[model samples]
Target chain A: MNEQEAAALFGALSNDDRLRVIRALVRAGPDGLAAGEIAEAIGASPSRASFHLSTLSEAGFVHAERQARSLRYRVDFDRIGALMRFLLEECCAGHPDLRSCCGS
Target chain B: MNEQEAAALFGALSNDDRLRVIRALVRAGPDGLAAGEIAEAIGASPSRASFHLSTLSEAGFVHAERQARSLRYRVDFDRIGALMRFLLEECCAGHPDLRSCCGS
Candidate 1:
């Protein structure tokens, strides 16, 4: 990803609630979780969860699918992978110390 | 790194200028660069670079050391490693796809 994209992705992750939401989705795995289920899991109101999920979706960190009555949110592993690569390779310049942390 | 710390670190990285400063510092390596040098390298004004550097320093991504007449800024590899680990392990929950991106 380019620096601008990286900055925007980081901006999406700059909130505590969003981070919590991402973690919740990660735990939910590929099947994902409905909006209300995510809200209950993260202790956020449905509206607050929806707001953060929308921000994450716009940033390409998460994807939503209409299942029955609500949207099911899932973490986008490929996008997240690209983000980590950008941080480790571009930002860190593949520093050996930082690379080792990634088990590279 | 907890969710709050990760959010704060991502917040520090949310700016384009700050991202440029970080990439410049990574290129500069362990010897680091003074504020004036970093400003020039990133094409930012001295004051602008100083402001972003202060934010990065406060967030523990970079640390400043008094070196003669100026403060030399360097990326904290350990802290950065921790942040990456937080994203890959904690946020991603050690997902195989994400782990592979980290070369784990």
Candidate 2:
């Protein structure tokens, strides 16, 4: 993941509402949840949920799939891991003595 | 780190200038860089660098210490690691089949 990608991902997760949406989808498991279910779980209006989902999907933090008549959203775990690695690389590079920073 | 902390950290990193400041500080090592150096490295004005540094410091993403007449800023690696863990925990909880998502 490059700095630009990490920056975009962070921007996507910055809002409270969006963070809640991501959490809701995450708790919904790999099968994911429909748009309405995500709205219900996050107590967001359908329009707001749709907006957040679109932002997340655009940032590559989450993926959306057509499921019957509804859309299912799930966290993109691989992309997220790459983001984690990008940040950890900086940490270790900045502090060699703290090379164990990401070991745990 | 909880959702709130993670959210605040992400919010701090959402800006392009702030992200550049972080990259500069990371490359500067633990001793960090003075505010002017950060501004120069990122091509930000003094006031702008100060604003970004204050936001990052407030969010606990960076730490600042007085160095003579200047202040040195360094990334808080532990806080960053905790934020990564919080996000990873959600991924694993959301998808048991992806337990290795964070292993790499």
Candidate 3:
């Protein structure tokens, strides 16, 4: 993603419920979790959880699939990695000398 | 930063000008920048830049120093690093197998 896209993605992450919901999906792995499961994990009202998940999906941070009547959400690692790298290249104050600044 | 603190910091980064201003300060290293220099670096109007910098400073992403009429801004790498690590630990969907998810 470019700078503008990164900004938009970060803007989406600015919310507490959204950030919690995304992180919960990240922990759930590629298989993901259904809407109810997400709400349980994040301890939010189902309506609130669904709302946050929608925001994450719209930002391209997560992918949702219909399994039965439930919507399952999975982490979009590609976009997450892209964001990490973009921040490293464009926003990291991380110094090469410090080596602590960049790379995992 | 805790969850709430991380949320707040990310909230500050949600804006384009503020993100640009913070990133510029990150690239500037510990010495930071005067208000005018920051404006020039980001191609923002002085007044606009000052406004953005104030936002950053208030968010604790930057620290300002006054030298005569000029105010210098520095990246609070501690906070930047904190935000990164928090995102990794709290938000990374990364697996140990996919070490790419965290650290850097």
Candidate 4:
């Protein structure tokens, strides 16, 4: 990704609530979690959770799918992987010290 | 690291100029770069580069060392590795999809 895209992604992740939402969804895995479940997981009010989830969705960090009535949100592993690759390869320039962290 | 610390680090990276500064430093390697050199590399004015550099330094993404008259800045590989580990293990919960990005 380019600098602007990467910065935007990081901007989406710059909030504590969003980071908590991401971790909660990652724990929920591919089956994902409903909004209420995610709210409970993050100890956030439904409205707060929804706001963060929307930001993550907009940033392509989370995917939302309609599950009958409620929308289920899942972490986007491929997008996150792309972000890691950008940091490790593009930002870090594939430096050995940083690469070792990825077990590369 | 916890959510707050991770968020703070991401916040430091949530700007194009800072990201550019980081990539340039990565390219420069451990020898690092002086404020003037970094400003030139990123096409930012000295004052603007200094502002972003200060933010980065405060966030522990980069280290600044006094070298005679100029302060040389370098990316902190260990801290960055810790961040990657946090994302992979804590945030992503060691999920296979995310782990594969790290080649682990």
Of the candidates shown, which would achieve the greatest TM-score relative to the real structure?
1
The i-RMS of every model, in angstroms, reads 1.2, 3.2, 3.3, 1.3
Ten-residue region with minimum lDDT total, candidate 3 chain A: A94-103
Full-model lDDT for every candidate: 0.88, 0.75, 0.74, 0.88
Give the TM-scores of the predictions, in the order they appear. Answer: 0.96, 0.86, 0.86, 0.95
- TM-score winner between 1 and 4, please give it: 1
lDDT per residue for candidate 3 within B18-90, as digits (tens), equals: 7778777777777888889889988989999988888788888788888888888887766666676677655
RMSD of each: 1.1, 2.6, 2.5, 1.2
Better of 2 and 3 by lDDT: 2
Listed in order, the DockQ scores are: 0.80, 0.49, 0.50, 0.77
Deviation from native of the Cα of residue B76 in model 4, angstroms: 0.9
Model 2 C-alpha lDDT per residue in residues B1-104, reported as the tens digit of each score:
66666777788887878878877877887699999999999898999999999998998878988999999888877776666666666424534333354443
lDDT of 1 at B65: 90
Docking class of 3: medium
Instruction: Summarize candidate 4's per-residue lDDT along A5-101 as a digit string, tens digits.
Output: 9999988988988888888888777799999999998899999999999999999999999999899999998888888888888888888988886
lDDT of 2: 0.75
Query: How well docked is model 4, in DockQ terms?
Result: 0.77
What digit string (tens of lDDT, one per residue) describes model 1 on residues B31-67? 9999999999989889999999999999998999999
